[model samples]
Target: MTVWDRPEPPARPVPLDRERIVAAAIALADEGGLEAVSLRKVAARLNAGPMRLYGYISAKQELFDLMTDEVYAEILPEERPCEWREALRVLAHRTRRAALRHEWLADLLGGRPSLGPNGLAVTEAKLAALHGLADIDTVLRAVETVSSYATGAIRREIASRRAERATGLSERDWQRASGAHVTRMLATGRFPALASAVHDGADVDAETTFATGLEWVLDAVAARLTRPPA
Candidate 1:
């Protein structure tokens, strides 16, 4: 056919799937935090019309679920730790690491039931580690409690890091600036306990702090396991 008579080649559309949609959302989140992600933006990133994403995910919430599950896949270690304490400890640390990698995770951590397959698998691993080691009630409580600590701790860590990045100062430096005002408050002598803590507390490593707190929580759980019933 002559060049003028030739039909234009069919336009190639970007492939659309849940994984690609979720990846686009994650890239947006990683670049600008969770608040930056949107269905329209994600669709644009994949070079598809916004309505195209509705086929894979119905709402923004579903997209959040997918993002969370992606993080869960990263949190689950290939080699499961054998002992219950070690397994739980490793699970908590891995989760914290995942939050570090994907700061948006801290916002959604334990905020809702993780119904995704990988999320369910993560829950199963935690329960399996404690199965037969404790009563069902204790096992459930143990899993929930450990998750609570990890989630709360991770949120705090991410907040601190974001603040550090914004201000270009570690928490200690931020505190020192606040300490100036605190020192003035101390002179008023109305806040003795706050004064003592502020003056006496040492700023320690975050990893060490998180590890120590997890061990303390685990120790408490162990006590419950061994304690005699009334």
Candidate 2:
């Protein structure tokens, strides 16, 4: 005897595309932070299943790479600025803003294996910024120095932000927290430079500190480039 009727298959609409998935992931990150972003969450946001997302992105790392590139691509290189110094300043500030928007960015960029278009684009842009330098070796060194400083500075800034948010305190609170330790160290009279530096308000305005350090880095690069052949 034949079956009375065959059940009809469910109609499968066009599933979420990569761009849509990535967009949802970024929004999730913005709302709840990177920790809140997961394949399942992204899929849930799109009304799909976690396994469906895996088809478009092989792993969580890929998702992270895309998210990072999404953030990185927002920074625009300066166009014919007065000097490389100004260009570098703009690029540095732009990158700092990107990192601030997504605090986990520094940790991702610093240690992750290169994984996507945006990541490569950022590296390529930085390399291109040093294009006119005299030597490839020098250019490479400059890139290393600038990139290292950017990553480390961004990471520290993220930490400081998180600390402030969690403790409901500002840099002033940080100074207060360390006051005892600092005072005791000063009282010992063994570390003159450290004591004097702290007493003089060494860690003051963050913007000024960032710019000063970046300028110092640029100066060091220029010094190396102009040094006599050895």
Candidate 1 stretches with Cα past 4 Å from truth are 1-13
Best by lDDT: 1
- Candidate 2 Cα errors over 4 Å, as ranges: 1-15, 78-82, 112-115
**lDDT of model number 2:** 0.75
lDDT of 1 by residue, 31-129 (tens): 899999999999888889997776667778888988988889998999998999999999999999988989999989877778887888899999999
What are the lDDT scores of the predictions, listed in order? 0.86, 0.75
Query: Which tens-of-lDDT digit does each residue in 89-165 have in candidate 2?
Result: 67788889887777777667567535456567667666676777657888888878887887787788788888898
Residue 161 of model 1: what lDDT? 94
RMSD of each: 8.2, 8.2
All candidates' TM-scores?
Answer: 0.90, 0.84
| Candidate achieving the largest TM-score | 1
